[model samples]
Every structure is written in C-alpha cells, then in structure tokens.
Target chain A: MDIYDILFWVLSAIAVSCALGVILSRNPVNSVMFLILTFFAISGHYILMNAQFLAIVNVIVYAGAIMVLFLFVIMLMNLNADVEPQKGQLVQLAGVISGGVLFLVVLAGIKSARPVTIDKAASDIGLITNLGKVLFTKYVLPFEISSVLFLSAMIGAIVIGKKEDAKPIAPRDEEL
Target chain B: MPVNSTHYLFLSLLLFSIGIMGALMRRNAIIIFMCIELMLNAVNLLLVAFSKIYGDADAQLFVFFIMVVAAAEVAVGLAIIVMMYRKVHSVDINILNRLKH
Candidate 1:
C-alpha cells in the first residue's frame, strides 16, 4: 500500500460518510454542514485527478458560495431547533427501493466502461482557458439559453416565495 | 494499495442513492437542497475520474459549467426556502403537498 492508495481510501471514506450524514441528520443546519465537508472531500479528489482548476472551482462554487447560502437559509428559517424528525416511513421505503434500483443500474454501467483512446490534440492545450474558448465558439448558444433559463427561474422563485396573504401554503389535511 | 476506478464508481453510486433518498424523504427543504448537491458532487467525481482515465479535459471543463449552474441553483433555491419558511413558519416539506391539486 502506497501513499496514493491511502489517500484514495481516506478521502473516499470521508466523502461517503459525510454524504450519508447529509441525508440522515435531522437538523437542517447539521445536514448543510455535512454537505460542506462532502464538497471539500470531493475537491480533494479532483486535486488527485490533476484537475487543479476544477478543484478550486469546486470548492469555491459548491463549498464557499452554494453551501453558505444553504447555511444562511437554514439559519434564517430557524430550522436549527429540535424539529421532530420527519416520519417519512412510506416515502422512505419507496425511496430506498428506487435508490437501490438506480444504484444497480449505475453500478452495471460502471462495470462496463471501456477505456477509450485519448486525443493527443485535446491534451496539448491547458483546459481552463481552452474550455472557455470552446464555450464561446462552440457551446455559446446553449450557454446563453441556460443563462436565460436561470434568469426566468430566479424570477419564478421570487414570485413563488413572495410574502403572502392569510393562508399558509400548507393545506389543512397535511398541516402538522 | 491503489484503489481502482470501480471502487470510486461504486462509492459514488452509494452516495448518489443516499442523495436520492434524502431528496425523496426529507421534510426540511434545506436538506433536500443539500441532497441535490450531494448528487451533483457524485456526478462531478465520476466526470473527473473518466477525464483522468481517458486523459481528456473536456469533461473537467464541463464540470466547470456544472459548478456554475449548481451555484445559481443554490442562490435561487435558498431564496425560495427562506420565502417558504416565512410563509409556513417551518421547513417541513410534507406540509408542502398542498400544491398538488
């Protein structure tokens, strides 16, 4: 066993455990924190893959920006208290079944992946800037459309979350 | 002691399924967002692993775009969660089924 082996095991273990914690933790704040740890661990894996740009961006976007937003919303919502664990027995059973099926499908796919030949031309240039070039020259249309979609989604979110009249969104039957 | 890519893939599959379970079963909207992040991270890991094994950089670049989208998602999703909390006083998602009509 070499350093690479040890590093792989340790980081993979941390990522998997923290991801599980994100799902299992009852406190939303705790769950968000676990998610942060998971992101950090994943960034480490990216580093191992020799993708330094992706590593930094992964940490910055997912860990620094997105997770902080999650923390703020969780704190703002006051979900830090001892809210009863959601008794999602029926939904959970169904989730487990589906999750199992999906995992099997993915595992089978992974088992069959062929190592295709790499193009020497692609690796001759550094990807950080090359990707930008591609995005502008080749992928620009999809890029522009996604940004528009994001803008519309942002508008929809603002509209959906706007301050309301007397009624809570939760109907009476499901209200706890 | 070098672990193969299959090891990482199986682990990723487990993490992805866990994320799915959280998204499906969690009543707290915040946790659901985190689970989605988990799933994205799993996919990102797979992309990078494939990028390494194939010696390609395009997937890594694609991951960069994905990170941007995920961040945008969080900004919007957090805003919505805060709004929902203000209106409902709790983030219990089961309470959100009222919109199903």
Candidate 2:
C-alpha cells in the first residue's frame, strides 16, 4: 500500500472511532470533545482530497467555533454522566439495528455502481483562488443571500434567547 | 489498492450510520444535536470526495454553503436549547413530552 492508502485508512479509523466516542460518551462535555476530534479527522480528509479551503473552514467553523459553543452551553448547564438521560436498552438496540440496516441497504445498492478512479495528482480546482473566482462570479447571489440568512438567524437567536418581560405595556397606557 | 471513491463512500456511510445510531440512542437533546452535526460532517466529507472525483468546484462550494447553514443552525439551536434548559432546568428531552399534553 502507498502512503495515500495508509493515510486514508489511518484517518478513517480515527474519524470512525471518534465519532463512536461522540455517541457513547456519557458526559456531554466528552461528547463535544470527541465531536471536535471527529471534525479534525474530517478536515484531514478534506486536506487529503486537496480541498485546502474547506479543510481550513471546517476546522475553524466546526471544531473551533461551533464546538466551543456546544461546550459552553454544556458547561453552563453543568451536565455530567450522572445527569445524562439515556434511551431504554431495547430502543438503543433497535436504533443500532435500524442504522445498520440503512448502511447495508445503501451499500448493497451502490455495490454494482461504476467506480470512477480518483485523480491522485494535484488539482487546482480546490485552490482558494479558483474557488473564490467561482464563488464570487457564479455563486455571488447565494453568497449574498447567505449573509442575509445569517443576519436573520442572528436576529432569531436574539429574539428566542431573550427573557420575556415581566409586565406588558397595554395600548391604553401608550395613549395615556 | 489505492484509495478510491468507493472507499470514501464506505467511510462516509459508516460515519452517517453511526450518527443515526447516536441520534436514536441518546436522550440528551444536546447530544442529539451533536449527532446531527456528525451526520452533516459525513455528508460534507462525501461531497468533498465527489468534488475531487469529478474535478468540479461546485460540490466544494456546496460544502461551503452547508457549513454556513450549519453554523447558523447551531447558533439558533443552542439558543433554543438554552431557553429550554432555563424553562425546564434539564436537558433531558423526555421532559418536553409534556408539551403535547
């Protein structure tokens, strides 16, 4: 096996195991930490595929920002393994079985599909310069729209998070 | 054998299944949320792999947009979770079943 194959196996193992840790860990904090590790492994895969921009963005946005937010919330709530709730054992078993069935079904369906050989040689399409050109020229509308979505999401979060006022001022009070 | 598209496909599928299993097994709302993130990452990985296979940047851009949406979703979702915690004083989702009644 070549270096690429070795790296792929190693990274995939790390990712899969860490993802399991995310689910199996009793503490929410541990789950978050495992999820961060899983994100890092996924980012490594992105880099392996030469998608430098996505690798960086995944690390920054997912592992750095989003995970920290999860950690902060978990810490704020003081959740531990003891306090964590779990589904019944039968339900957990069923979940595993159902998920496995899905995996097997999809695998069987795709098994006969044509396998396209990946070009292992370096490609420029994943580079930031090319991606930026495409993003701004062809996808500019969606980019701007995403910014608007972000603004609305920000507003929505604020409105949802803020505490309700103890007293409501009536229209008659405004008239007075 | 060299790393092929099929290998990546299998890897992502495994990850996605694990995510589904986690989402089903966990009763903690935050953990479920995290499982959703895991599933999203699995899809992202597959998308990047496809982008590489086809020599296309569009899939990569789609991954970028997915990331954007995920970030916003986390912000709003966590706020709602925090609000729920404030109201119920627990992150256990079973407690929310009272909403139906």
iRMS, all models = 3.3, 0.8
**The 10-residue segment with the lowest total lDDT in model 1 chain A:** A117-126
Runs of candidate 2 with Cα error greater than 4 angstroms are: A166-176
> Which residue pairs show backbone clashes in model 1?
B27-B93
Residues A1-176 of candidate 2 have per-residue lDDT tens digits of: 87778888999999999999999988788898999999999998998899999999999999999999999998888885457757889999999999999999999987887788888888888899999999999999999999999999999999888886645856576678
lDDT tens readout by residue for model 1, B48-83: 877776776667767767876877677778777777
Per-residue lDDT over B1-101 for candidate 2, one digit per residue giving the tens place of the 0 to 100 score? 77788898899999999999998889999999999999999999999999999999999999999999999999999999998998888888889888842
Q: Please provide TM-scores computed only on chain A for all of the candidate models, following their numbering.
A: 0.74, 0.92
Model 1, C-alpha of A56: deviation from truth (Å): 0.6
Q: For candidate 1, lDDT tens digit of each residue in A4-123?
A: 667778998999889888888777778878888998888888777677778888887778877787777767666688675666588788887888888888778878865443222224
Cα lDDT, model 1, residue A2: 60
List the global CA lDDT of all models: 0.76, 0.92
TM-score per candidate, chains pooled: 0.82, 0.95
Distance from true position, residue A26, model 1, in Å? 1.7
Against the native complex, each candidate's DockQ, computed on alpha carbons, is 0.51, 0.85
